[model samples]
Target: MDLKLQKFLESTDFIRAVKVTVAAATPVILFSYLNLFSIGFTVALGALFTFSSDIPGNLRHRVNGMLASNLIATGSTVVISLATINPWIFYPVLISLVFFLSMIAVYGQRATLVSFSGLLAMSLSFSHSYTGWALLQHAGLMISGGLFYLCISMIFYYIRPYRYAELRMAECIVLTSKYLKLRGTLWDIRADRNKITEELLSLQIELNETHEKLRETLIKNRTKGGSSNQNRRLLIAHIELVEILELAMATSFDHNKLHHTFQEHPYVLNAYKHLAYNLAALLNELGQSIENRKKYTGKHRPFQDLEAFRKAIDRYEKQTHTSGRPTADEVLVLINMFNYVEKQAEKIKVVEYTFTHALHTQEPKHKDKELEKLLTPVHYNPITITQNLSFSSTIFRHSLRLTLTVLAGFLIGNILPIQNTYWILLTIVVIMRPGYGLTKQRSVHRTIGTLAGGIIAFGIISVVHNSTVLGILAMTCMVLGFSFIQRNYSIGATFITLYVIFVYGMLTPDIQDVILFRIADTLIGTALAFTANHFLWPSWEFLSLPTFLENSIKATRDYIREISVFYNRKGEVPLPYRIARKHAFIEIGNLMASFQRMTQEPKSRQKQLGQYYALVVLNHTLLTSAASMGSFIQSRKTTKASEAFNAITGAIINNLENAMELLKEEKQNIPVDKETKEMLKLRFTELKEIRKKEILESGGTQNENFRLKMEEGQLIIEHLIGLTNLSENIVKAVKDIRERQ
Candidate 1:
């Protein structure tokens, strides 16, 4: 098989699309052959709704979610079908159901999906005026379809239980390789640092998302029962990926300073860049090997590059010696850079051996109840829904907007002489999201995609008259449409439009009218959704950015505090430290995503743009630097936390706390103590002197072990000083944003 195609086939999304297509289309096709097309179509709808609730998770959650969706969707179909008898009854019932169902999203992601299934059923219920027994028959068929889909899902899980988790891990590994490559490119002398930095930040958000998905898939299963060998291997891979990311972040240095220091010798910097790129390539190859279920046997050895880089550094020192050049600090910086590369290479070696040899690195196992805390907690309590009843809650506001917009769409469809009025409601439901930026984006995509699809569908109908070909085309579109719906909405919408048009074309002789109606109803729906989002309590990103920023800073603080605790007590990294690190990454990713969404919104709605941008960059640096320090401590044997280390970490945490307080509108300037600042400076000076003495004592031929120990001490001091400076800057940046507010 072609590698790309093989990867796609192995993906969880493709598998899901296949399951959905089979579940939905099989019933319709079979029943239609039996001249029971109506029942078949009803069953198809039921299956699709239940499929929507089959989100990624453990077996129990997956089964329970689909079952709940089956019940909810069936109830919705029945209630809406019965109420459609009277306009007065239908409008009130529809409005109340929309509000209640949409508000359930406050419960969590899984609940949101289950709620979406209910709303979808309600929307489709408007398509026909089925009364009494007809409604009961439809509901029954829907349950049958849902049950059919549930059975298929369980069978697939039984056949390949680790498939989803494995794919998720593969994705994270591949993304981490890309991340390493981007981080490596920062060493390029001619690279566009700003653009690369933005890409790195964007990639961080994606990695965080994938990490959460892995947690949902792997952690949930491990918690459920005794984990199988396959599950344990995947869990270990995920843990390594997380730590590898930290190693990548930790390996980063002050590029500006590096560039300035190497201004006269760009070749040395190029050597570093080359080694970094080689490391990335090695990692990428390993990821591919994992994805392909093959052993990675070092097709391209980065160890060679590491050796070459070491040689290059030796030559540079030899040349600089005659020129009376390269000060002591510069030599120390070189050692630091070399140490970073060597450390990363060593870590990658460990990962490779573990993967290829199937070595089970000891991983801590949590009990079911304790492991649940690792996944994003969902509150099933009714109070969670009731608390979001206020307008201040984004979910509540979104629910209200959806209800009112859907009601208006229904009314407009009724007033207009339109066929398939449910299309309008479907459009409204599909286009409107909780946030203005996404809603606006979807409205545009939906409008363009519908028109484009209609034009193409018209041409296809005009040119082709074969029923077999049309059926094939529609089926193909269904598969592609389902595959892209979550991955790429615009492309999904286009294919879905084609699927709809082709299906309806077979039923009606007036294909042109069908096309026109689809286009018109879509336009109406998009307009209503866009208008409602803008004018009806729209959730803007800018207004929420401050809260995100505060959360990011707070999480960063907690993460650093964990490192501080570890500094005094070094051992294997504990679960609390990993949890804190995970939360920090998540919060920073959220802040970055919020800023990105704000950028997409109208300029009038974007506030303090430059300041927000600065904060994003600063927060990223703060987290990365802290990770550098933390990872270094974890990976190596380091001295106990001296008073200087304690003072510096305390200052960093204090700055972070003050930043949060400032975001909360509490103004206070808490500078690093003058004595503590001197302490850091004094420590750095002392390290340089100690390094000088070590070189002299060993007659400039110190054993590698002794040299590494000296370098580690110098590196620790450097990281401490840099972190102290960064944390103080974060304080100033927050104060500046506060003043603007």
Candidate 2:
């Protein structure tokens, strides 16, 4: 099957869309048959809003979120419906409600979704003509509908508890597969390193998000009684997938440097690239099998490829010795690259084994608090909201911006003599986000989708006026709209517009008026949103870049410290080390996302973009090197921590610390002694000579352990040196940016 089609068919989005559509359609169908279409419409609206909070999670939180959403949406509808009794009462009530509802987003993603439901309810309340007892009954039906949808969610979850987690794991594998293919391209010297770096960082950000959600689903479930055979297997596969990402990240190299040195050794590079491509192919196949719920039958011969790749490097090492070109650094790089590939191959095999064989081996369980730290924190306290009431809070500022923009939109709608004036408020509520870049992007997408949907819906209504056919089309659009909302917002908007038009066509005689008003109101609302976000307290990415960079540096430093300790006491990867690794990746992802957002903003808002880009690249490389060093130490049997190792690692850690300090405009005094630097340089030279001698002596006929020890020492020293240099460069970049500021 085609992968795109397969993704859609097997995706959680598709399943959730089916559930959401059913939740919405059930009430409408039943009530319309009984001639209570208005009540059914209200119920369907309630179900739709409540289902928005049904994000993937453990059973408890998922239910709690939906319950909260139902209560908020129901309460908002009742309050706003009654507040519309007078203009003075309506104005203040609407403004305060929208602001407070938007402010609730400070709690977290689930809260944000729940908050959106309340805001949406309040906005839609403006369209209602009911009053008093009728309004209360409408609210009652809404609560019933929300509860019904909650039951559906619970039923689906209990029927297939691990389905979401399994799908997420499959997604992780697929992302890692794509990442591997991109990583492979780095071996090609002529490839655009800058473009690839940007793409790789973007992919890492997506992977980090997926990994976090999976942690919430899989780890949280296991701790709360989800340790069945299937859960164990999926957990093991998830662990392997994370290790594969680390291994893939570690495989990154300074391609320019490697190309400069190995200009004559293109074949060796091709060998590495080919092996990487094959590994990616294997991962792709593995992900497909996982998605299809089938055991991974071994198909690709990765071992043979590994053997051939290793021999190719060996042949090159021999050639370097005969030529006496002094390319020892480049040769060691090739060896380390080979070692990184070997680690990934071993991890992939473990994942395959976990899938193919009966799962008997149990991975160690994390304590509750430890597992909690892996997932995104959710705050429910009122104090959390109070703390964010200040203007300094981005959410607070966004709330104000949203409130003011909505006020302007409302006034314009009232003055323009347009029917269904609430359409303007609806557009504003849907299009505006906390960040300017996203608001701008969404405004454009909403405008385009509304226009296109209007045109398409107009054509459909022109030819086919049958109400039954239109109802089916509306249901299908609702399904598509829910499915694509998170995956692709523009497409989601298009389908949602189609659904709205079809429904309004059934409700009113003037189908063309509905379509025209929707488009015009969207344009007006999006323009107001865009203008408000730009002129109001816009959350510029540059202002937050320093914190992101500092966090990444600190995480990277802690990770290097863990690696240093492991060098002295080599064993299984400690929980602390894993935590540090996770923090490092997450922070790096945050930084990348910030930089990407900055790129989308106005050029004038892009402060020191070039310097920030340099820092991003150097920081990325620094963390990659740290991961490589840590991975090597954990996987290999090697000598204890040498003094030279301490000297290099100490310098690297100090450099990172200094960079963080520079970001904070604090004085930095850490410095390595001249003698220590000279000693480290001499020690590295001695290690390289020993490694070369071991390789030449082995010549396909010597002690494997001895050769392996020499190789480990050589690679470890090189990684330490490269990391130190990257850290120093990062400090310089930070200093430059600080000076400019």
User: Count of backbone clashes for each model?
Assistant: 0, 0
Per-model TM-score, in order, reads 0.92, 0.92
What CA root-mean-square deviation does each model show from the true structure? 3.0, 3.2
Model 2, span 295-389: residue lDDT tens? 67767878888998899988888897788766555666777778888888888888877777897666566454565566666668899999999
Off by over 4 Å in 2: 1-6, 86-89, 254-269, 293-296, 313-334, 363-373, 665-706
- Tens-digit lDDT track for model 1 on 417-516? 9898899999998899998899999999998889988999999999977877888899888888878888888888999999999998878889999999
Give lDDT per model, in order.
Answer: 0.84, 0.84
Candidate 1, superposed: residue stretches over 4 Å from native:
86-88, 259-268, 292-297, 315-327, 360-373, 666-709
By how many angstroms RMSD does model 2 differ from the true structure? Answer: 3.2
Q: In candidate 1, which residue pairs clash?
A: none
**What TM-score quantifies how close candidate 2 is to the native fold?**
0.92
